[model samples]
Target: MPERFPGCITRVRGISAGHFTDTRRPTGCSVVIARPGAVGGVDVRGAAPGTRETDLLAPANTVSVVHAVLLSGGSAWGLDAAGGVMRWLHGQGLGLDAGSPETPARVPIVPAAVLFDLHVGADPARQPPVCPDAAAGYAACQASLERGALAEGNVGAGAGATVGKMFGMGCAMKGGIGAASVTLDGVTVGALVAVNALGDVRDAQGRLLAGARTADGAALRDTARALLAGEPPAALLAGRNTTIGVIATDAALDKAGACRLATAGHDGLARAINPVHTCADGDTLFALATGQAPAPGPGLNVLAALAAEAVARACVNAVRAAASVQAGALWLPACAQELPVAP
Candidate 1:
């Protein structure tokens, strides 16, 4: 792990409490807000995405200090899980009018994102249309703030996530959430990603890490190549696929800047994943500022590139942390190497 940035850097600590799998085997992951009054913004790239409270990230939105963030399974229906987060935040009096002694106290906002995972072949009862355990994961996020240590891999939102949908669910590989950070000229930029792309996972050097084979381990052409050859890209569906992520920095930025940064961060996803942001892919990125430090002096372009690199690193890490499932297993290339740092 890297050292925390200077000047009141935002400290992140989260965990996966309990997990809920839908009839489609999508897993729910949740995290709590360890710090109060954290500033944030969001960018949505996927045309067919399912989300909750994203409007709060807009510049016109007045609320701040989100109590928690939820990433889960259950497709669009998973949006219901946020109700539990509201319930928890309400109890702590952590919302808008948090300190007031009124019957209707304000609380921290809770924003959530979801991925598709209905084809993993888990028990039907386990793979219901909705998941309440996702809310339990939010409670766990709060508990993890008091408790030390964060758990990763096939837990939380990544619990039931899959990648390389070229052949549909039958050939997708297990993928989950991943995080990474980098320091540029003394400023820190970190990224968190839920790696549920419709394309194959690759290393920084563009080597295929997984998703180019049949379940039986037979080698297949690259998803992009297959698509260009007029083969049916089974994974490229308009409403069924998406990859989501968040970028956090200490720099002071308004919502518009945050949105621009989020757009730039998508370059990282393009670099790390093949055939990204296709008509069938719903890719989104969120940029957040804790407002605890000044922006780097090198200029916004430098910061943008740094943010993009952090996004790429986060995408790679997410793929690396994904656990193998029965339908399709994730495989990192033995010969894969990291990209060389720019001179």
Candidate 2:
């Protein structure tokens, strides 16, 4: 059967996403484009983070909307992808109205972040480290703009991604992109996450799905357990992971409410991924509202709860959809590859 696109995020009118992958380079990006602009806010919880245009979303900032959000690999170098997104939106005449006087103009507003995936993927001596740049970002935007057809796993920002590096790549498992959404009384909430963390992925039932493996390549081990064990080798891996995502909703909301939703989304991360929000992990979540659907009578809290659940589900979906690959000398099996994890 063909792959199914998770349509949760796209369910929100005016919101669309595109995934562009460069298989040869083995690195890419995910672009979430909002029609014109959508009310937006973000929360960065991880100690080490790489982001751009987030200041514009501050509660006191003048810009209340964002045209797009970019999540990419290549650490800070991947931030360049937002430039391409801006260029694309500009050509479509979408952006903040800054030009005055005679000529009508619009300056696109794009917020973006990055995750580090250079530790492996290709042989260092042969392929050279790969990262997404302006050209690559522009190309992804050009591929599609309409809603639906959401891509997950080994693609976009999740490409060249890995997780559970607590014991280094040898025992680390593969991580990728995932998405989920929910609808309540006409209000729709959804999430899309790039699962690259220094922890393990778990299902709602608290079952260990994927993460660090036994040294002999046997069973999966809880990342936190390995660290608590105080093994001498556990100190080898430091500050080399991140999990970034976007929370989308159709309900009307202001920047403050959006920020709250972003903050609440982290609770889902904590439940789904063990040992999150670490100094080595740049776990950030962005929330956007299109203002088309009616806000619940109880306010944004209702939507926020839905958003949290959606994020937790998306994290698991990311790992399940991931495909195993040979990253240079490192080999990351599929979430179900030769392992006893249920897919």
135-164: candidate 1 lDDT, tens digit per residue: 554554555445433444466666666667
Show the lowest summed lDDT stretch of 10 residues, model 1. Answer: 334-343
Please estimate how well model 2 matches the true structure, expressed as its whole-model Cα lDDT: 0.82
Give candidate 2's TM-score.
0.93
Error of 1 at 276 (Å): 1.7
The sequence of per-residue lDDT tens digits that candidate 2 reaches over residues 1-343 is 2232354677776778888887765678988888868999999999888899888888898889888899998888888888998999899888999877798778899899888888756556764367888887887788656445677888888887777777777988889998888888877888889999888888888878778887866777677776677754355433478999999988888999999999999999999999899878889999998877764534677888888898998898888888888867788876776455321
lDDT, candidate 1, at 230: 85
Best by lDDT: 2
| Model 2 clashing residue pairs (backbone) | none
RMSD of each: 5.7, 2.9
Q: Pick the candidate with the highest TM-score.
A: 2
Give each model's whole-structure lDDT.
0.61, 0.82
